[model samples]
Target: MKRWSRAAVVAVSAVAATALVLTGCSGSNKGAGGGSSSPANGDAASTVKQAADVMAKVTGMHVSLTVQGSVPNLAVTKLDGDVSNTPQTVATGTATLVVGKNPVDSKFVFVDGHLYSDVADPGKYADYGNGASIYDVSTLLDPNRGLAKLLSNLQNPKVVGSEQINGIPTTKISGTSSADDITTLAGARLSPKDAQNTPTTVWIASDGSYHLVKIEISPVQNGTVTMTMSDWGKQVTATKPA
Candidate 1:
């Protein structure tokens, strides 16, 4: 039997609400476990810079995403990754938002029109009504989600700490969040939390498009969650639906 996180299940269930697109990464990519980027690539010297450069190339593109709230309170993290600026690929012109997200878990989302997940049987999630597919959410993540702007606004995130994550050495950079750190996607404005209590830390990638290899978020009042990426597949030629 497969155990899907509640948030992941909801995201999978709601994927059909957005427009869909199909694209694939060029060149050969490895599976979850094949080889890994050398530890040298994860050096603090260039981790932040590398992520910035990669995100810059993919900025301003419309990307739809199905962000599942990992926390039990799904409502809080439901809209973790909302695409407002980007036009709806499947929903025509609807903005999908979810709240109540948790940290420390994998999620289900659209990957080039394909239902994919870090978990099992992800492909079966091709249904959510309204012609929405998993890839539809992928279209919302296009750098327009304020990722690059967040990174740029960061006061030089550094590798202040490190730990072994899935056998890979993960680094942490501590800093504060800001309203400007948030990016406006499609047409909506996403403002990062400005509370001093919510100290944010961005993980450093060893190599490739260092685009936020992972992120740790803590709430002001209480609670915390983390989002980690297990794959960095090639660019999928997905576009925002008109």
Candidate 2:
């Protein structure tokens, strides 16, 4: 299997998700939601407040999610599209993030709260690629993690703008990277292209739990990208291979 870089998967998901926003009735979080308040349209100041509020409720909490989203044009093809309503099941195990999508043709499971890529064994297990040490790749974009560094790909920087989602108003945020933000998001240094791969987008939510409802990423070199959260659940389990 070809290796899928974490940044490619996430940043694109960030963009493809935005398409989900377009499907709703006037971008309102009404028909489908976690019983939480509908997302709202607000400015950057309000967005940060919403993000902080929603993040406080569920951050670090393992939840079960029947997410029907897609990462189109992944690994190549510019990935300027999106997919929805697929049978994608996600289980955030108390210890790890486990995904199962028998029909979707893809599943990514994080082991014991860590994101490490193990190369296929050529008769024996060994490292691959540039041999860069892998950290908690799963937590890179998780709004709950407050580290010293943030990856250009994962950091949800200060709110930049705002837009309505699911019939609700929301705040837009730009996730830019500098020495500190990069360190806080990624725990290391990265080049500008790496930063470009990093996604910048708008966040939508009604209640405080800044549950990500919609996102759009546009990179100069790469095509457009987006991801949207269809539903949310809690205290779910993702069983992993022993």
Candidate 3:
């Protein structure tokens, strides 16, 4: 196992949704978890509540992420992976790192309470500690404390407009939220220095499902981060790295 910097660990598990890209790992099983709720477009508040409920019931899905200027000194340009909810919390994906004028590829996997990344020699893995596993899988869709739950805490959610996400028409909403809230969504505890209330934007499916189609969060110093989720109700399986 390779040692990962504490800062990277914090960003991966604590601020991935707002300031990092790792939080994109999440999924669920409908039988073990709750089902989607009714879509509410009666008003902005109702819409958010409905979407939040639908998102909380997600059992498993694919997550595609793009982050800019998030991690200090590390310019990550792209990350895409699968988030599972059947077995245990696990997120496995590949990332594109931009260095100088070139892009580099790397692999990352979190399973069984352990994180492995950038494998170089065969059988040699850099371990990022057991605490580095993906955010609580069961609660990944929990409306009370899940990503949607955190977004609900944003101040004054307003329907900015509507847009098409992956061809699905979606209602766009924007609001302001605290960095603390973002960290809470990632399922990682944080210290005072890591807090930075930030502005956030979310897009919800307008077809009546109220599923979360996209989210954008911007912190003061960190660059803007955007995440797109799809394949709702999809099945995902993660195996421990060999």
Candidate 4:
């Protein structure tokens, strides 16, 4: 009877120890997983500033712009193309414009501060004189008045959360900016009413690169504008149309 009691006590102690070890490991894992979804470094504004600084130095990238609803002084509804800021700011892409309730698609190239598009004259490129007829893609990369400045001018930026953008992990941030800054960055115009404190959201890569992955802004009445950037540092060449 004494031997049996001693054996039972030893067995109970071993079971309790195993349970404790397992509980500890489970708690540790839970903490680690929770951290992955939290804001990095616990400073959302600083992260945005860092991302802006990084993007200001990008040489070339692929960009996509989409607009839903009407934006004042902006005619292009969609644009997709490669842009390079090295040596000069240039772009080659396709654009969709709304003309009197109809959508017109055209291939265009911006070089030497001139916009050449087949829409202006079919089979031959017509110089639009710096894209006054349509939107200018190069303005999106202007160092002082472009995306970098927009990011730097964010008001009350806060980390929304973390998510994946095209298989790349990113931290989402929300903020507001002046209509003038937003329009300058997008090369668009907004009305006085729609321009007041536009709500903006941006996604920055969380992999320590701090690259600007996406930006969305609501700067029009019942409309939204979104831009996504990818293929960073890719080579882009734009030449004048013959």
Can you write out model 3's per-residue Cα lDDT over 1-242, one digit (the tens) per residue? 99999989987776546643433322334443345432233367777878877776777777776766654333456768777655566777776756566676778777776767663433455775642242233344545656767656767888878889999988888877776666544433434454555678888898989889898876535666677889887776666676
lDDT agreement of model 1 with the native: 0.42
True-vs-predicted CA distance for residue 218, candidate 1, Å: 2.4
Of the two candidates 1 and 3, the one with more favorable lDDT, higher being better, is 3
lDDT of each: 0.42, 0.39, 0.66, 0.86
Better-scoring candidate (TM-score), 3 or 4: 4
TM-score of each: 0.43, 0.40, 0.68, 0.87
Compose the digit string of candidate 4's lDDT tens values, residues 16-107: 99999999999998988764656654589889989989988888899999999877777889999999888887899999988788888989
Give the range where candidate 2 is weakest over 10 consecutive residues by summed lDDT: 77-86
After TM-score superposition, the amount by which residue 67's alpha carbon in candidate 2 deviates from its true location, in angstroms, is 17
lDDT of 1 by residue, 35-149 (tens): 6643434455366666656665542232222233332222223223222222322112122323223222234433234433332222232233322221234333445444555
What order do you get sorting by lDDT, best first? 4, 3, 1, 2
- Cα miss at 179, model 1 (Å)? 2.5
| lDDT value for model 4 | 0.86
